[model samples]
Target: MAEVLGAVSSIVTLLDLAGKVIEYLKSASHADDDRSRLRDEISSSVAVLMMLKARLSPTSPHVTSLQTTKTLAAPGGPLEQYKSDLQTVASKIVPSVGTGRLKVTVDKLAWPFKTTEIKALIASLNRQKTLFNLALQDDHLSISLALQGSTDALGAKIDNVTNDLDNVKQGQKGMVHIANSTDWPELTVPVQTEAQALEEKRRIEEWLSPLNFWITQDDTLRRRHKDTGGWVFDALEFRTWIDSPGNMLWCPGVAGAGKTVIA
Candidate 1:
């Protein structure tokens, strides 16, 4: 519970920093395309943090969750680092209160960050967002493991989450953005002959897998007991991962955890 409280405090501070960034972006009259994009990206990142805050609220379901929160709130950890970076950005972009009127006016009309800098900030935000998403998934898995009463299984899930966190801390892929349908008209695909299409299909099949995954999926579904793993479908992390394009739900459990059935 102490760890959870610490994690929530970090999240609240981050939210406050993020709000500053958004506010300054909105107020910048001379903001260009990059700044606008940065604003949108920051907003999306904030949503991930909001979800994380909700997960840490009240009592988390299991020990793994407490472990995760502890790690996140540790000194020099991901959440602290994220907060530091965001504060730096906010300091650069946000206008100072004690500035002269003319200086404030000039600041409001000028964009503070370079294009390269904006891109780097966006990338950092995306990385941290991915890390938080993984944390939320860890919390969900912890709940399931607690219900099953498998201590070994819970430890294994904790290990998996820790590995994932390390990778994310080293900088990994972030939220997958799905382009709107309106962007379809901008795409230019080449025309393919019947032979070419067949060749392409063959390549896709080979790339997907050497064996038929559909058959394996069918078998797993057949083995699934009715109402089993239904909680997974209803979990916040699961629904968020589904509704948000390119987001992944990392469900790690020992064998017989019904992973395939949940899928």
Candidate 2:
């Protein structure tokens, strides 16, 4: 953990130095296309390093493997190579404080790196940036896999809870019983006569619609043989529709296609 923390701190210092170098290049008195390219490359590398620092930081939610972190921060590793190359670039571009400074005067600064050297440094930074991006992507994949596993586990637990609740509801229904009482007439459930029932059904049908859906359903079922459409219930698509809420299953066909019978 301490090693990772130290690594994070080192990258922070590198980023700061890179920033200074970029700023100095931006303010150079002389304009060179190669110099601008070098500054852009340094800027891109700084972005990559910033991402690495986030992954290594102790406060980060992601748990990057210790081995991976150590490998990145290891001696002569990618980060080290980046630091060495970046410092070389800085020494050539950024002026020193004392007599070692390369400025011809207080206002005019000197450009020391040739076109080929600047191109070489840019190529080096490109390679290091690729490495940093790869590491961050690996961490992203790990986090995604972890979240998927948790979601699967939670779904299983929810299924178990749903089954348990169903069982409890069934048990309660079975426990229901009619108690014996001296006043049996008062306790008895009222039963409507056949004529009264028919009259009530007709009234409801008339109040709702002229067509009687219940009679149509009865006629359809009567014409269908016993268990004629039972195979429809066994279909995988039908089962999935039943399991999922707010799902609709449409069965479309020409006339006399058994659509109504199956439904």
**lDDT: which candidate is best?**
2
lDDT of 1 by residue, 141-251 (tens): 332233333448645655665565555433322211222334565544343445754565566445433445465456445556789787888899989998899777798
lDDT of each residue in 58-146, candidate 2, tens digit only: 67654345645665677876678788888997777677676676443424666778778888888878776766665554332322223
| Cα distance off (Å), candidate 2, residue 132 | 1.1
Q: Which segments of candidate 1 are over 4 A away from where they belong?
A: 59-64, 99-103, 139-263
TM-scores of all candidate predictions against the true structure: 0.52, 0.49
Clashing pairs for model 2 are none
C-alpha root-mean-square deviation, candidate 1 = 19.4
Which TM-score value belongs to model 1? 0.52
Top model number, TM-score: 1
